[model samples]
Target: MPVVLLLDIDDVLVLPVGYKRGIPATLETFTRRLGWEIPLPTEADIEWFEAAGVTSEWDSTAICLAGLLLEAARLDERWIVPDFDEAMDRLAARALDGAQIRPDYVAWVKQAGEATRLGERPSQAALRLWQREVLPQLPRSEALAALLSALLATTHSLSCPTTAVFQTWMVGSRAYEEAYGRPAPVEVPQGLLEQDQPLLTRDGARALTAVWYEGRLAPAFYTSRPSRPPLKEPPPPLPVYSPEAELAARLVRLEDWPPVGLGRLFWLAEAVGLHENPTKPHLIHGMAAFAAAIASVDGIIEIQALQSAYETLQAGELKGPLAEWAEFPWHVVLVEDSVKGILGVFRTVRRLYELGMSVRLTVFGIAPHPGPKAEALEAYVDRLVPSVNDAIEEIVHLCREG
Candidate 1:
């Protein structure tokens, strides 16, 4: 089985340890060290973690293979697959004890558990108990095991695999009461959810509270309070490429200039080619990046400069609301073959956006129809989506500047 590597706290490093201090006072320590908080596990769900050689210090769940990543040498954190009985040897393990739980999160789960019933409220008393009692007593190793076991029993998400974890709070008190009949289960500590509770997954689920824990934890507060103001004194721009990064600094010069022309265009395409091509199929997708890079290259004014500009465009900076457009209820993602013919998608997206139909496109590179008239987009998807003939031409048309 391909095991999933989801963590409880997305950020699993110690903030204080870096400054030669102990753990940081708040969740900042967790975020500073680990990047994001995965999900909290209950006492019963620990077996899964132990099976994977993960130990939870009061503040972190350490992984054996993370040492390599910490040392900047490797990223293979999985249980290695052995070849023909070569029993996979364990990689380096790290300590996960002697840390502290993020303070605020500890309180929230606890409140939810105690306010509700053991098995009566959303998360119940059991999970809270685990959070309050068992976690403190158990050594890092034991706490991790118990917590993983408790969490896995009711919270393991089969749908959101990979680093993605789906969790909820105060889900289905009556349902929980029916299933567990206790505020907290015996095996779980004080605040861990008891068995027989509704495990929240997607945001749409009624009984569950959906959460997205990617690198930054702020999505949890996306609709909440205003974010910290932009730094009054903006941080100075740092060089994007390191002196020893191996690539020529010329490649990193796109921050100020618009890349233009054939030579610059090819490099742009090549850069994207490097980013997308884990396999052969990506070479084609990379073309979009190539085209955009050409358009972005400095000192450009003609169609020819397109290739260079396409190569220079930074993707994330342009990728915002594009994802939102992708979620249009009526829109469906269909591959159009006719869109190809060397730079066709660029024009295609351009036309679609011109016509006012939001198109979620990612040919040669990802592009979206900025916004479109409803009828036109619906008609286009029906008539133009899913073609094998014009892949390049269509994508080139589809991805062009609006």
Candidate 2:
């Protein structure tokens, strides 16, 4: 068994007072972040902040990530205080935080209610319907909480070892909301609720998966969001399944993993080899095979391995024979919206290889030409060709420098 500390950054640990949508700190917020406010970025603020050179999320993520690691180590503050760089560089997921429910999942859930009154406006309709539709999806039934405990345990173990993910806010209630755009039907205890803790926050703290730090898995953190204002301003923390409650959830799903909307999964299957009628009864057969093929990447499951597994699934899902993976020079392809100008880069690729200077990544584009010239790859490089060739050379130069 393993325990993992999942930390979120938006409203749990830091936030800006009047941050505008799509804009980074207004110079004022920027200054305070370095000193006082831990600085939580709104969903839109990440990109805006990234470009403005706010400390890399990785850097800040490391410090917070170490908190749980410290508690787990039993060595406490001093041990974690020194390993900031390694933790920042290694402990955290690059972009694994926040939550947004898929719209389609809710649509399916709500369809069951005939003429159900949700609301008139789109926002209100969705919220009201989710209350009716999504609440039933996770009702506490026979052993539901217990099964959740095991899954949470497994997830905790996997989070650090296989693409370590400490979601700044991967709350169960959040997952409830992520799946249905609303909180879980469960209520917060009166004591926790009285302190002004959000039901989501109160619920998530309970949901953290527990782990034994006897070096069973690599050292990892397991804790809840500290309620202090500065440390608690980021996003809410993800919940863990208390061991008992978790086991209950597994039993709840025992009949099967409740079918997930697999449009993306379906699309991945088609691309990978999932067919309606296939020689194989199942597209995937094992967790390892499935994990090898599909993994949580950048906070989303990438089904590449699941598809790759299809090639091997015939006898058993083995990494397909090398011939299947062998990369050949791709055909000169002109895709939709393509102009004739792409050929210039193709020519440059051919030329560079001939010159014994093959590019690792080939690129070309039209430059802001002073004027036009003979349409040719050489003409572009020579600056004697039209905007197309000139663009190619400039593009090539930028690519090389980049």
TM-score for all models, in order of appearance? 0.16, 0.20
Question: CA lDDT of each candidate?
Answer: 0.24, 0.24
Q: Which candidate ranks first by TM-score, i.e. highest?
A: 2
TM-score of 2: 0.20
lDDT of 2 at 124: 25
The 10 consecutive residues of candidate 1 with the worst lDDT sum are: 217-226
Q: What is the lDDT of residue 30 in candidate 2?
A: 22
Q: Write the per-residue lDDT of candidate 1 for residues 297-349, one digit (tens) a residue.
A: 22233233333223323342123222222233111122321111112334434
